[model samples]
Target: MKQWWIIICMILSPCLKADNLFIEAESFDKKGGWVLDNQSMGQMGSPYLLAHGMGVPVENASTLLQVREAGEYRVWVRTRDWVKQWDKPGSPGRFEVLLNGKALRTTFGTEKAVWHWQDGGTVLLKVGENSLELHDLTGFEGRCDAVFLTSSLDLLPPDGGNELADFRRKMSGLPAEPEEAGEYDLVVVGGGMAGCCAALSAARLGCKVALIQNRPVLGGNNSSEVRVGLSGLIASQPYPNLGNLLDEFGVVGHWNDWEAKQDPSSARSKQIREILQRHPEKKIHNAGPATNYEDEKKQSLLQGQENLSLFLNMQVYDLRKEGDRITFVIGKSIISGKEYIFRGRLFADCTGDGEVGFLAGADYRVGRESKDETGEPRAPLKADRLVMGTSVQWYAEDAPDRSGFPDCPWAIRFTEETCVPATRGDWDWEAGLDRDQITEIEYIRDHALRAVYGNWAFLKNQSSKKEQFAGKKLAWVAYIGGKRESRRLLGDIVLREQDLLENISYEDATFTTTWGVDLHYPKPIAGMDEEPFLSYCDVQEIKPYAVPYRCLYSRNVGNLFMAGRNISVTHVALGTVRVMRTGGMMGEVVGMAASLCKKFDTYPRGIYEMYLPALQTLMRQGVGKPGFPDADKLD
Candidate 1:
């Protein structure tokens, strides 16, 4: 990468004095050069007060205005006492100022009586037109009565100037030397629920296990980042014993048809609600719902486990092996920019994206298998051209007492489509506000939030039931994208949709995923009105399918195993396994099989033959019914 720096200077005519151009605001309630960004109201599609008017304190209120002429200047202001309930120590009541949108160090600590303007803050005014801003960091408690500007520019080194430069310098430095990852009996990549369970299960067996998680936080889609609730089988038939371990670990919550109580009842609210109501006992939370994996560490949930070592924010960069004997692996950290080298006897590819298998030179499939490849009825004659796109979500709240629309940053198309009134059962998935291109995904998500707020404004101001939308508001915008599908790894056994619906039970079955066979098509391609194409196979439901251990291991890389949606399956088969519970179970099995391999000092494939009894023992300990119960139950 290259760097560039450029600066422009404008000279002012002598007749134009520095004193002529200055804008000031005494309050924010009425046209004081302030606007409420009502795009997100708290997931409720409504508007609320933006600044001092809303319940939010005014001490940290931000104000921006233009000044036509520039000169060295002294800026001062008075502020009332900040409300202590929301203020913390060392926090100035009238905090921070900005020049030309860049923040300046300006503050009035809460020490004296009301409205006392202090002195001694100045900045060098560049020789042209400039913008001056005063930000109310504490919440603008006292009124901002007036402004003072002078020709004396005292330019001190800007705050955060070196801090930012240091950050950039650090980012450019070479990453740390890779850690020496010793020969792990079993190495599991990806740290979602399944991967976590797998790591713990193997470690508990006295096997030295290394768990690699690409993300800082685990739980996969069910994690707080993606926010997709878990749903799928709790126990494979006759395997209630297999489901016991997950049940003990809060995995039983996804079986419900109703939404988790913590879920927001916005556009897709009904769908979530329906799921939760249908399955009342599933474990779920709405807010602070374990979105961060570091939270798990604080709780000490996995502490004191001798066998497992969970590495966060680390990604598999490469894998080295010959024939079936895998030797070592390479990993890189996303944050500290560190790399690691791990030598493991057996590895599991739970990265969901199949990063492990792919790096190990495994044969993988990126799209749907042709009908000729699977012989499944619903298989397309050829691969479909489009793939599912990812989505980000937002939240909003309604205005109090059905007020007029707030000055939110709503797009033109949003205001046109968001004129509806709020009613019970009014939210719809189809009510979003943009096209379906990947480049425009964020555009749609933002507009969707804006549309929700705008419609709520209409409800509060003009709709027949304005009274009903009085207090709803948008609260949050999910920090991460909710992805649906991506690359998949080819394994020793390729699972077809026909095998699922036909209920083919493999002798080497490790777990079963019961989410209904489902598939989503990209919105109709341009110039075509009907769906681009749909097969009878795509249109129908398939029965629960048993996943064999073989499908989780690589065809090319012997020591690598895969879990989650990236397993060897046609696109149609992935629709079922993509759900949270199934992914979790897959991780659990992979971990246990890895442990079994470590105990035998062999690879994952060896577990099926030489360590079948121990694998059975692990299955009996995990979720799903223990297959071949008479053979060997894991102690």
Candidate 2:
């Protein structure tokens, strides 16, 4: 019995050691530890150097040292420069290194381009490793990977010293800040499909552009965070280019690869191809779930060849103008509590909420306009009567061996007396979730998704349907609501249902939207007592509608441009034009117009009278067909 007790004590001794091993890497930067020395770089504030590298790096090119724990450690790295000299043609690049407050006498060689830390040379680190950092002044360079060490067993080599050094050089001399006094040539607000194109267009045309985006991710609703598939028409007989350049950036392979396996006649495949052909250099921006834009400098197109910069995490607090010509925009960062003063020659209010135009003394309206306002029979007799309420759509994932029957908040409401007999919720009034009021949509969607999870769990553990969903898992919950419609900024041209149904085309038309006036019922019970949910539409056949250039610019503000569902449209008509594909087209047109504004040094309105030809040419190159010089198409 005593021997058995000794054996048990011996087994537990390893679990109860004197001290467990841990490691921690440190540096002075935005991260707490070692701060960088940028006095030689003319930095007024303590700006820590951010790293850059060519090719996709495992961590951020900005990430120098990744520490897992705290303990005595040995850290070693090999680096190289791009300079191929007579002495060593491919030697390690020039690099700066600091280990434990001591600079190492390490000259980089190019021969070790593929080197990892364990290959002969490694850095030594002490317990509670205080500081270890390398500055790659450049943004992103070629072959810069790092390996940190707390123990000899955990050592690995570093690669691409010259590439890292090049990154450092680029980071050393920062671009001069925008002239604090003068107004910018063009100011684009929003970073969705449209806003991104608009800023790129204006910048390409040599206009100083300041793109203001509120969302952390640039692609807006189509982003992974938003989790919606990209929608647009491809350039062919029926499809025109919709502003889908950003979506193309995130595409891994051809859409046909997936579509061919599912449906060969899928038109969505062709549309995706057209978008990819136009913008091949699309870059993906993943903001994760519920990400907040921290620094505009880090995320925006701040490094434009001309003077286009993005300000993220910054909210446009107010708008100030001089009579008709807009003057300045005041914004503040929610994180830093810093203020930004943007003075632009022309302003574009691309805020989906039309916040900029609404604040800039521009006239706007919410809901449907009456027949008197826009002589359309479909228009409600009462002006501003019925607006498209916002929708909150959500999705649920099935679990593996699904046995988690979580309870739904609205489960009590789902009594057999109230609901129709159905297994899963669908687009019907029967067992489908109910969302009557705009204010209640969020609550309804939340509860609906919750109910889905709960139902799955009940089937797995409690319900008789356990055999069906034995192994299912609930994947995720959408934190942000899929907001449908909001305030529309009054533009130079008010689009009506007639423009869509009629064969009318302006010489300065930018893109065409083909979706019909599709509207949903107010509530499940409002229009349906004996039936389920129903969608109504006046037009049965699908026909393309022309969206003119005038619709993109504000009626009142000089520089303000508009896009997405907030563009000028009658309530009934907005039902059609507010589709995501139409939004992409609007964005592309906005981008092209912004470029034209920069090229011709003209206001957005001026493009209608002056640079119409240039705008047409841009469309021809981008979307495959310019809307102008073909008035017969309208006939």
Candidate 3:
């Protein structure tokens, strides 16, 4: 009877044959310029790869696959023709797939708008390691999600939605629930300068912290990836030690010296040139110090902390909430496709987009508020959709000889009158303020790229000063767009512009914002052709004002804390507090609050209401490096 039962089980079991191979494009071993874009996951089904060709075809992305069986297998790729949604003609993004050393006949990035599997003819594979490469044919932003290889020729890949997610999980052999990562006192999402400071401060205060970042590097906007300089004041009156962490991690000198009141041909230019010559490897065209060593220094500091566990290239997508508190967060490794379940007593939403708070049903606001709502003079009369735009900064280097640039007819056209004849695309080159900053990030980024390519082409080919630019070659253009504003999580006290203008002081004041009410709007240039990408700044300077602790934690979410640009503030007030230095101070204050939470075994509201004195004590003591010189101050 036992022998008969064993034979029957063997006959009925479905795991007798070999499984097919599935490779997620974002998990490729070598992903050159192609970036992992997960912003549109809700609409696209899953995170995918974006070539982000800023007018030039980026490098190819390749991955190695170890075949289990030597046999013929059919190939299918999940992709979409992105521009097709606009009802536009011609596919801007076109690319081919290479197997081993040969190219597949089927070209990708030319399909319909909706994501679906495009069939690539069957190919023979040997029982060994095979090379798969995404060869980009155009410098025009090709994209892919995953590649599916199956022995059965008739097997169709899942279309999309939850089914596609399930298919990916099954093929990748991932469990339904993510593997237990570990318990932590605080889990801080986003590895921007603010998040970094928060994690470091919490760890210093004896809390086991998990710092999860979507990108490979720390310092979101200030990192080499985005290259925006830190602004606003640090180590101001109320809290002298608040920005010690910022000073330890920030670049020493000012970046926009040419834009200052001083003349461009001053001795400062010569001094800067000499400094650049000393470090030729760091030659960044108009941008000073392409890579900041301070980021590396901060990463080292975080790693040295025994209580803080840093997880790079991990994007937190979902959270498990028990009532108002977040029990755990689910993050997927961008390179390995492995899910990590980060359990924690408290969570910090330092993500500039306020994504974690949005996921947890925290009250938030986006775009501008009306005069009736905010009661600020700067507020719009009838709050229309207008938010601060993102910047895609670029620069060019003067070659020894003449350099030729290809005419990008696919890009938005720019005439001589509409072109910006500058070598560097600085802070003023901003766009996408009218659209959804978070949901339409890819579009915003691509539009900025189009503006850059179009303007450059005009300068090289049609402008009267073409002779002057003939020897210049485009050196660098940031594919990772530096966003300015997004969803601001609502807190107990929504800091208003009146608070700063009137110099109202709160008893729970932690940090001071020194920047002016700097807002951005489209510049009115003569003979403008398309949507103006370049923005003009409108500044309303005010004295440095203290930001209160009540604006650091979510009002509704029990254990939620926030920092960075997403902290509770009116649009007018955000104009002053959104800068990196001020945001870093906010992170410092939240870190102190987190420590108090751990000490008292309470939530964020509890710290604000019942244990305010304890938090104030920590603020007075400060959590930064002891005896650090107060070099950074508000003028």
lDDT per model vs. reference: 0.52, 0.48, 0.80
Better of 2 and 3 by TM-score: 3
Candidates 2 and 3 compared: the better one by lDDT is 3
Query: Across residues 317-427, which tens digit of lDDT does each residue of candidate 2 receive?
Result: 576788877788876443332457789877776666676887787877777677787888687777754545432223234554434443322222233233332233322
Per-residue CA lDDT of model 1 for 441-555, tens digit only, reads 3233333333344344455555555556556543333434455556688877888787888888887887777776776653322342322211112335656566887887777
lDDT of 1: 0.52
Q: Each prediction's TM-score against the native?
A: 0.61, 0.57, 0.89
**TM-score between candidate 1 and the true structure:** 0.61
Q: Pick the candidate with the highest TM-score.
A: 3
- lDDT score of model 3? 0.80
Count clashing pairs, candidate 3. Answer: 1
Off by over 4 Å in 3: 1-19, 32-35, 52-58, 68-72, 85-90, 250-288, 524-526, 626-635
lDDT of 3 by residue, 1-635 (tens): 34323322322122222337788898789997788777666566567888776557778899888876789889999888766765656677888888997888898988777678988889888887899999887766788999988777767766766666766776766666788789999999999988988998898999999999988788888777777777776656777667867765633332233322233464434543454445444343224455533567667778888799999988888998999999999998877678899999999999999999999999999988999998898998887778898898988888889987767665667776677889999888898888888878877887788788778888888889999999998887887888899899999999998898899989888888988989888765677656668898888888988898989999999899999999999888899999887888888888889998999989898887899899878877777774322323211
Candidate 1: deviation at residue 227, Å? 2.1
Arranged by lDDT with the best first, the candidates are 3, 1, 2
